[model samples]
Target: MGADRVGSGRGRVGRTGAYAVCGAVLLAGCASMPDSGDLRGVESTARQDTQVRVFAMPPHENASPSEIVQGFLEALTSDDTNYETARKYLTTAAGHTWRPELSTTVLEDAPETNAEPVGSREEGEEFVFSMSGSKVATVDAQQSYVPVTGAYSRPVHLTKNHEDGQWRIDALPQGVVMGKSDFQRNYMSVNKYFFASDAEAGQSPQPAAVADPVYVRRRVEPMTQMVRSVLKGPTKWLGPVVRSSFPTGTALQAEGDALAPDDQNKLTVPLNARAARVGQGRCEEMAAQVLFTLQNLTPAVDEVELRSGGKQLCSLTEGSHADAVAALTSAQEPDYLYFVDGDHRLVRLSAGSGDTKAEPAPGALGEGEKALRTVAVSRDEHTAAGVRLDGKALYVGALVSGGSLGDPVLRSEGKTEENRLTAPSWDVRGDLWVADRDPANPRLLLLEKGAGEPVEVETSGLDGRVRAVRVAADGVRIALVVEKDSRRSLLIGRIERGGKTDGRPTVTVRELRSATPELEEVTAMSWAGDSRLVVVGREEGGVQQMRYVQSDGSAPEEQAPTALPGVEEIAACQDDQTPLVANSEDGIVRLPAGAQWRKVTEGTAPVYPG
Candidate 1:
């Protein structure tokens, strides 16, 4: 529906500038001035150009009530510097009180408006507008936005004054309403990184960066808004898992000051004195947070400088410890796709495999007696976790030389074997996540590398059993395949970590939002990007196929990519740019970038580092 590029809006500035220089200029020969000077007749064409953009203005003063209503709705889709033109159709009092920034309601298509001339339009009239086709998501007051699904309706009240028969809206909804295509053109998604509390709460060995994606106004000062959002802290769903390094009261030293990249691509941010008290370690952490957030913008910033009270308190470069923190946590694609072979042993297929032969992994687990049903590899590729075929046990061991698969790390406590456990997922912090799924004691558990017992994660509002669980690379959000009402639905739950008094960390999950409400059954899903997932399911009457859906249940205009035939299982990492791998009936197939899926002979339970 719109340009499919992520940062296409920024390209318009250069194109607009070129047009201003060539077309927006008036010829010097056409200029005439009353002067007696000799140069008056000999006109030199001096270059004088200014950027000009056409804007939608308010309706005429004598316009009918319906005309004014239509003009107002069209203006809502424009940026127009704080929606200045859109307010023209509103009464002076209403214009001053209405805030279009509070939230934005995304509609399926253009709204249908009908005006009812109440009492001959003397006492004023009302216009009712109804829109259909799913309402996707709402951006809240704090700019925290989540995916949602529903229908929406609103009414506009118009009044006519005696002096000038000008029809203007007196009251309406507080925020702006637009369609999905317009929202994509006017808004952008950005991920702001915050430090996970695992290390702080004694759960992990060190700190890791967690990414939280939010939509911001694309034409507005997005870099400034991104930094301000980071200082404001993570969204409500993510607040429990991550903590901002900036102090609580820390804010921009100058209000509305945007962080612009210098010639060196370094962003200098001026913060209040509240951040100056932190030591060098915390200062770097604060800088890392800003760098990771702002780097998502167009022409990404390579480094960050934190300033306070007009002095440079700290300057962090891209290769520094803070800049490297995020890279350390995210999973990178390995050279091989590791899985189990028909011999009940661990094996891998090389990236450039001309032959069909598969090689055994360099570890004892590859040659162990236990038959693995499912396997999950850690981000570092140094360790692997596997669940027994019977689902009664989980084993974790090393993937390097001199490493051996030892005793089962966790045993299922379910009364029956089928109710034992689901596949295990590993987070960046070297912790494993699994679901017991036992009807007797159905719950989620987290296993730290060296902890004595698996910590039970509190899951609220979970109606059905968690059939499958996958932790995002950020370690904040989790995707669960929940079986409820004899069907499966994809739900996204936030992971919250709390500090306990006994020096142990407490983890809980809250507000499980459905990502595929229209689908009657979702068989499998994997994280394709930071805020998106590729799900295999049946939507209403549609057949079971792989579709790309947002993490918040919102749908994009572009159709889903072609489904891989006969694929029973799929695997993708957090980085959406990488190719997707699937377990097909023929063999393991890999989808390269812009290429068809090709079969890689002989493997089961294929997995990428997550």
Candidate 2:
């Protein structure tokens, strides 16, 4: 919607040609007026007529008064060239006064006004007609062509004409003038090309058909520019920068808990308590890698050398101790090493390209000279939990500030019943749950902050001895593997806050089946989700099977029997996304979500390689 004007005349028109021609025509019809009496009657009738017309009209169905105004303005500025449809609503005099020759096309639409109505008054109205265009006019005889465009509009005053059949409208107000220029003419051409082309009709243009490569490059240029902008920040670049700086192959290590298989040869060993190890192993051991140390007995020196795929990767003594720990603990891309020191301090190490190292012993345990027994790192590695030899459990411990062994941030005592302490499993919320060994009155001890004594959760109806205990992610649900009368079962029950069991903490059990149609002994159980559990068991034939049980009774499912390989021990990683299994004679293997089993690390002695 635009217009333009060009010079037409070279000299200014005389007064007669400029104003008299239009004025005479307008005033000619007004020369004769009706009688005063007739005028008053006409005015009264016209007032009633106007009122009736206004009342009969429906309420403004459009959005708002401002919207109506904007719509009218848009119609006026349209490129349709004919504005009669938009001008029909204005008074005759207003239309005549519009200077189309002086006005230019609208460059941009202005924001609508927020002003609301405050009533209206009108003056006398008059009819007018005029036409004007650009002219090169000389006021002082020197001729110069001056471009111009003009429009006309009529204004009507309603309030002042209440008593008479008369209305007044001056020429269109100066404030209503819209500007015009050559730039607007150029924009008009662009607008026409954009709106009137076959490309706008969804047909590919000829240029696009001829140069596919250039078209693709142009299409992708904007996205590439945006990516460059996003990567220009320090924090934004930090990730890739660190990755590039450290690169890969940097050796690092940390000490953490490693799960080992229970030795049936040791009669005093707890059935569920597997051997724990503390020593250094390579960070890349895909199998269960555990390190153990006997009092004054050095591990086989040959074992210290790093090996991969039966080939030596590097000598252990070649790297600094700190660097070795850093590399071993770094699990970036799934490389991890579990270490055990001579003092029985356990550490888990992941070696990536970076210099980050985790010292599970002192870093998480805080200022402690105590030996660490069992340690577990969550799937995210942000959380590490360990049990001290003092029969106490420590958790939420972080690595030392400088990547060295430091004290743990939080410490709590293990569950103790009748002067005997039992190791506890750390829940997602940092709470610890341990099973009491009392056969007649077994219970689960819950240790949370401010609770002096462990909250006893009765396990009477579980139908067996509680062999292993685990808490759900919510910390309110407990899962126990019960060996009931030679049959194995999984018991799930909620923990009551006040220790009252008025049907709130109801317990449910599901039997695990062996290949021979008999209930198999449950070896381990881990939560897969809010309502699912992954259970591992050994059939009579010694074949290992993993079963997924839905707590909500949705469906019972099981994975195909998988040979335990050389591994005699198995435990589910706390993460439901990946199931963690340990081999007594090999190493740890991670069964990733929806993927085949892969080795994570190799186990150390006293720590079965399984």
Candidate 3:
């Protein structure tokens, strides 16, 4: 969120009304308080080039206490190295103790500073001032950030220095707070990838890289900071599901690691002796983790060399076999959009051919007695999992011409039919995820392809009903629609997979967080991209609407497409560029690239291969 609009001439970025403490009485001993309103000369930087970094302007000679306070607050938004210039308005002791890196509270708009007199300003005495703003998010000391709703207030104490008659702040908050615009201008959003704990393992392994997005200082050794953040492990929210290839307590060398890439795009990472002690296999995994993490930089590092004690331990290139981790796990554009037709047959529309014709998928599944209520295709587009029309049984079968549907792979034990199985989603690993909402035995199950018993995954702290489930292509995160106390929440939880316990896959969920708190009800949702979800829901007493929200619960202000009439279900791939498919009451509709929704066929549930 940015500044609120004030008038038609000034544009949307307006001055924030704030409260502040003024300087000593200019005429007498009585200091005057500045009005929160009518404070002028604070212009918007909207017309300025956003790409250029804005540095804090230095305080002029012989500035008053109020002027010094206002200038200091404005300087907090600039790209001052170590905030050295910003500290010019603070006393020597306060400047040394004030740490701008402790936290960053992003505000909704430009904050106003009101200079109110605290008490009788006896000459050469201490003065106090306070500042506040409506916050959007707060990034903590550990760099764990979360979207929040509330106000942020803090007080600063200033005193006259004995060396000169100048006033300087002696005490203040530990960190700096800035507006969203400045945060965007000074900080860059970057993602560091880590391997899923149970990523695919075989002769030719393909481990999925889960992205953890964080904001780092834009120009101040960003590449170095990115590497340091990776060493710090995943963010708080994603730490539970993902694991670092580096051993516990592993980190970049403390004294000399600056992480600058050489001219040929090769980055030599200096690790402690601990990393060099690992075996070759473990070393390669660590290299893969570093390669994927550092590649997100603008001047991408193409190769990584790990060294310890001045000796090379391992080296990796972008083409290394262990580096086959897919960046964004979206489906390769397929030729068809498959669903169940009105005749209870598995049918597909020729989406790739730009044709509106519907045809049967293949042999038994297309023309058999087992009618599918909902279906999900694997990333390879060869296998599919379907739930029966009665929602009691699930079948896994091939999608080719002569493939036959298998017997019930999973059966619901719900006491009532309405509490049966939901749509099944297939990850790139070929594992199927579905929820059995039998109130008595409600559980989320993961079925590995070609496996017998579906492994029941436990969801700790999820008290209500699990209505719908969608697994991301990475296979490490799952989206859930949970209903509790008549309130529905769209939550994203990390998939904790315990590798092959007793020759069987074991899984659980942790770090559940709501993605869309503004919506009162989440009717349907699908993964639109790696870190975003296209959600369809309604506010209290509002009509059904469609909006895209980040999995981290930070709602962007993008305008959403209007809801389709009588829409029942929606499906999308992890690529935001891909078209969206939805099932309306009359028929299935397709939102092709840059086009409006058009009727595809008469169907109920539409899905793309994960």
Candidate 4:
């Protein structure tokens, strides 16, 4: 729920203020909170980004009810793996029932305590204190993060121990609540890898890995926690399109085991018999999953070797090109970027090179046989798809010079230009996707290998007309620009293929959900990473701006891209090393890594090989 300001500036993006870990609560003094008001108007008490570990102090003997409550809240922000210290502030019975790992509620700032009315607690009666803040988001037990809005109010009951005469909290919520800064300090986002369901069915040339991100405590044996998450599988939202390599019911051979890379940089994982039952090939795939999942997490894990019941299963080493798993899931970078020049002819420039000159693409489309409006290049860069300047015809041609565009692959019967076919997109499966905006007969169509009859995909729950389409590299997730009424929004939907029993699998774009809800209209978008997208759009009454949003709707403030003006079309490659291209006020511009946008040429409809 934190807004990432592009160019937020220097060391520690959005941190300021004093944080005392001695005892005041919130690292120290965070909820140095007001005691009377019932408003979540406090400023963000973001702590500095320091690696020093801070442990929660135990409750002092004979402490007042307020002191006990404040101390307990502070302990929630500490590095107690099991939260044992925080429990000291709770009554014996309450401690036994409290489940701190159930979930985490992140607020805009530290939570404040509002004292109960005077005389509300009698001599032996329990004390009640109110806690509230502006809710930002929540991390479920599975570690999936979802952005939230509005107030977060809850009550904690404090009781005097009859035996010791000291106050302790007797009732509260199941999980801990903390400010956004503390949440960022204590946890980190990590992607767990899985294979596309279609690829697992042997429908694609190679298995493509899709990323599912989850948050985990940064200092709490993260390696082991990550392994456990892998075994548990993907979150419910992504379960339909991806499959885990680990077998069902598979788990560590022993409970409470810690996973660490050895001095030799090899991580040995012990799995249960359920996992060891898999064949050699499947076992290697399992190791491949771990290798990719942890690649960004640490440098220690240079290799992964799987073992179960004291018997070795398989091993996967980083940079091992011959490894079946690595070869199947790794993504190749785009060789060139394509766009329509002033003459409506498709041209290309070497990817990531701002100094390169734009030249006509090899095929007939590049031969300038006919004018073009928008285009998509296949992942292999061997073929290209283009929508005609008139927007009525779609053509497919090879990237080779001298190639001829024989016939229009598809055409729209829409009466107006606005109802013509949208720009085309390619998936890793070698299939082409596009949408016909005809008011009377709108449709989302996919062409097998950019040829043959267009298959109208089934969209059961969609409440709008498709204005644009971009299929993810995994081919399981599809990003669509849908227009409902006068507003256009970006929605991510699952691509489920069925009826494979008859050889022709039917496709459906289901479970459509907003990826950029805060933006009232989304003009263009592209997959910028495995789980994130670079989008161009604006909020209600807001000016056009560019930002990054995760597939799950979380916009991390730290990675905000620099701004550009009047961008109509944007393009990006999965390789972060490549520069971002866009059609802006200065015409086609290039944003090289760590550099400002510079004019590339006068062009439009820029795109990278999908």
For candidate 3, give the lDDT of residue 77: 64
Lowest summed lDDT across 10 adjacent residues in model 1 is found at 11-20
In model 3, which residue pairs have backbone atoms overlapping below 3 Å?
19-114, 20-114, 20-115, 20-116, 21-115, 21-116, 22-115
Off by over 4 Å in 2: 1-344, 349-368, 376-385, 388-423, 438-442, 450-452, 499-518, 540-542, 552-561, 566-579, 592-596, 604-610
The top-ranked prediction according to TM-score is 4
| Candidate 1, 1-610: lDDT as tens digits | 1112122122110001011112222111122322111211212222122222224566665766656666676677554657888888888999999999789887655454544455644345443333234576787766656666776767777877656767788988898877666676566666677877654312343467766667776655667777888998988777777788899989999975666889997889899989878887788888888876665444457678998998887877654444344442332335666777887677776643434577877676676557888888777677788888788888887887668677887888787766889878887667899999789888899987622578888888888999889987767789999997888999998887777747566888889998888889887788765566778888777777887776656653345756776666778755444567778887777777667777777777877776
Stretches of candidate 4 off by over 4 Å are: 1-45, 117-122, 200-205, 321-323, 326-330, 500-504
* Highest lDDT scorer: 4
TM-score for model 4?
0.89
Tens-digit lDDT track of model 2 for 83-111: 44334333356557654333332221221
Query: What's the true lDDT of residue 449 in model 3?
Result: 77
Error of 4 at 40 (Å): 7.2
Ranking by lDDT: 4, 3, 1, 2
Better of 1 and 4 by TM-score: 4
Report the alpha-carbon TM-score of model 1 versus the true structure.
0.83
List of clashing residue pairs for candidate 4? 20-27, 20-28
Which of 1 and 2 is the better model by TM-score? Answer: 1
Q: Which residue pairs in model 1 clash with each other?
A: none
